[model samples]
Target: MKVKFFFRKKEPQFNSIEELFDAVSRKLSVIISVESITMPYGKISFKNIFKNIKYTRANSGKLNHITGHINYVTLGLKGKTILTIHDVGSTLNGNKIKFFLMKVFWYWIPALSVKKITVISEFSKKELVSIIPFAKDKIKVVYNPVKEELKYQPKEFNASCPKILLIGTKSNKNLENTIESLKEISCELHIIGKLAKEQLLLLEKLEINYFNQFFISYEEIIDAYQNCDLLCFASTYEGFGMPIIEAQAIGRPVITSNMGAMKEVAGESACLVDPNSISSIKEGVEKLIDDAEYRTNIIHLGLKNVERFKIDKITNDYLNIYKEVIEAK
Candidate 1:
């Protein structure tokens, strides 16, 4: 039997989904012949979309899995197809016309082409079901497996001068709020994504020490995890917060938003704070800083939390689903 995992070409700075399923496909190769097809053109304009669809159809395998972020490409496939929807929050948040178009092309029409749908978190599954109630039975919640490269790297908590790692600069990441929360705190804020001019100015004006880096390799990401004292991922919205578990896997305490998928993915392992309130985020950060015992406890729980997202376990989950789809009449 043969299986093909379809992926969108990696953007210069982001390819988390592609990286994730690539690992799964590598493990799956031990059992069956598997191929990875990256679309020639990135998912953009009508011409590029049409080209990607045609290319995907020509290269389709017996069982096709469209990894997250390019679900609309499933429109051109046939046979047993599995599509992973990471989150609809980004797609559905916009002007009315854009929202309606994304709802149809990205979600509704694509739902008709695939045999099964997989979501990264239960929150994402519920969000998808709410948008297309008819597709509820077809949806499955498949938690993302933590990258194998991120091992448990123990680091001494540096309360004297802590380094707080914050990933993503997108609006949903609540960077502005986090920056505000860190204003008076004496710690270097290490931000992973591109920062706006206004953000940089704010950091300078507030006298908040920060280190900014963008378009780095995955190795750099692991390095950031290893070097930091704690991870602050207080995002306002997420389909699934991978960083929460990634930090947890690296044996670091996490301070994340209390609502949405962040809360769900973190379970009882993270210091939960209200994403909307700067005071709440500040409190969570300080709690992890001042109380070494509490920080150690969180780190312990985080390591245990990551076991649920083990790569072998998650890969096996996909293997079972693939078998069910391939053997279906």
Candidate 2:
């Protein structure tokens, strides 16, 4: 049977979902097509929303897959469809009116329209269920597969003056706290996202040695993972912590939060830290830096842990769901 993967016109830097499904679709034996909907000037106006919805409806295939971030289009879709929700943060973080509207259009309506819903982690499934409890029975948990490009690259551990990689700068990513933790620590911080004015000032005030880059290519991202001594991903919240597995897959040790999906995803292979406490995060990093044997042990365990996120297994997981949804009543 043919399947159509519906996607939004994503920015160059934000193509993880597209890249993920691109890999998944290639491994599937069935015929596949891709459809990307665009909005005028890339802004979400009502006119653009309706136009995109109409476009999506007209192009609906035998089996439809609504990728994350553009769930409202599910309202206009006919036939069997599956919706993948990476997180419910967008709906939960805003003011009351915005939250109400997002709940209606983004979660409630689209959820009712789809035959099956796939969430990236158990934490995400619980979050979605809490918002729309009736939809719980149909929600399935699927972990994000580690990218195939991130091969296990063994590197000599840089014990002296180690280069620590931090992936994001968002508030929930806990970048500010991480920076605070690194104060007086002997390591170079390589951050992957654009910094705000306050963050830059904080770094300067802390007298930390750091390098920052934004909108980098996937190759650069892989290089970042491969080159770093350890990944510091102490996020306050996440649907699924992708970097934890990615670092593990690359044979690098990881330090991440001990709560939410970050803890769930790390699964004993990472150095777990309390995201709220700078001292805890610092101590985690410091242990990895000072103890050679412990760091090596974490890296080896991480390599084994990444097997759970293998692409073939994850691809088969999606294929099974596709078959079930297509064959359902």
Candidate 3:
């Protein structure tokens, strides 16, 4: 059967949603076609809404299944569409206006039209259900799959001055607190995303040794995980922490937030800390550095944790969902 996967237009920066479904498409057994649709420009745009509606209506019967972002949900394909809601982060951040608007467009409207809604983590599913209580019945939890190419590469840890990998530069990533926590700690910070001017200034003022790069390839991301002594992902919030699994698959011990999906994704394998507490972050890092056995144990746990997210298992999960949606039609 042919399935049409509708995706948002690719942005230059990191986007987990696109990365996820791309992997899903590669593994599915059915014929798949991907369509990139433009995102709405403003908070609520009638023009973009009409454009999306027209686009979906035009392609209604051309394929067996339609799937894309929740924001792109249209009323045209009542039972043939599936919507993926990554997170209700905007609602969680206390943006009341955005919350109300999202409740209307992102949840309630899509609930009427889409055949299924998938969330990456149980934490996200719970959060989404709290906002739209009626949606609890329809949502499914599908974990994101680690790329098949990422595998265990045993690399010796640098005891002298370890290299700590940091994946994102967004404010919610809690990079500022992480920097403060590592102020006196001796380690090289290898950051993946571009840093803001204020962040660079703070790093310089704190005298933290760091390297920052942007727009790197997937192979480079794997290299980052393989080379680093540990992965630090103390984000304040997340739908599902992909880096946690990626790092684990490469045999790197992880330090992540003790809240939300980070904690859920890490399971018992990662050193968890309060993202709001600089001292907690510091202490977690210190434990990983000062205690060799504890660190080694966590690394072994991480290797095992990664097995749950194997690409083949996650692919089959999506395949089942697609089959269910198509059979219902």
Candidate 4:
């Protein structure tokens, strides 16, 4: 069967969704012919919408499987198309205008046009179903696959000043609270994304030892995980906490939020903390630092947890979904 995976125009920065699906497509291509369709660079306007519709319609007839972003849902290929919904974050943010637009473009329209929807986590599936109740039966949960390079590599914990890895710098990543929590703690903060000016000022004011970088490659990300003593990913919201699993695959214990998909993805292998509470974040970190045996246990459990996110298993899941969708047609 021929599969066409649609993606938005590639950005210079790292994009988790594109990187993940691209890896899956490469593996799936061994058994089936798979092609990727990327949109032309343009502002989101009527012209772009028309171009997408024409592009989608032009290729709809030749492909056995079609899958892409939920916002790109078009009318012509209902049974053959699958829309991937990362999260219903717009609705959850309490922005009425954004919610209205999301309902029309991301949910209701996609619900009418696509045969099925794939979500990264059960939390995301539930959130999407709550907004578009009719889609409950159509949404399937498929966990994100870890990259092949991120495997268990034993490294001694940095005893002088433990290096704590933080993946993103967005507000939802709860970086402010994390910084506050680490004010009195001794650790080298290795942040992966561009830091806001305010965040930099706060870091300076708090006197937190830190390093920051952005637009890095996959190899550098693996290096970050391999070098860190622990991963701190206490985000307030997430579609799926990919970094938690990535850190686990690299044999690092994780500290993540207790709510939303972070908790769901971390399972029992991570130390859960309240993203809104500085004290909670501090305590969690302290526990990991002070207790060597507990830290060692979680590391072992994390290694085991990463087994479920193997590329082969996730690729086969997508292939099965494609086969089922095609056979049904």
The numbered model that scores best in TM-score is 1
TM-score of 2: 0.96
Q: Rate the local accuracy (lDDT) of all candidates.
A: 0.90, 0.86, 0.80, 0.83
lDDT by residue (64-94, candidate 2, tens digit) is 8887778888876887999999998845777
Q: Which stretches of candidate 3 lie over 4 Å from their true place?
A: 30-45, 61-70, 76-79, 91-95
**TM-score between model 1 and native:** 0.98
Cα deviation of 191 in candidate 1 (Å)? 0.7
TM-score of each predicted structure versus truth: 0.98, 0.96, 0.91, 0.94
CA shift of 306, model 2, Å: 0.6
Candidate 1 residue-wise lDDT, 208-314, digit = tens? 98899999988899999999999999999999999999999999999999898999999899999999999999999999999999999999999999999998999
Residue 206 displacement (Å), model 1: 0.5
**Residue ranges of candidate 2 with Cα displaced over 4 Å:** 29-41
Model 4: weakest 10-residue lDDT segment is 61-70
Error of 4 at 107 (Å): 0.9
Clashes of 2: 0
- What is residue 219's positional error in candidate 4, in angstroms? 1.3
- Local error of candidate 2 at residue 151 (angstroms): 0.7
With a 3 Å backbone cut-off (N, CA, C), the pairs that clash in candidate 3 are none
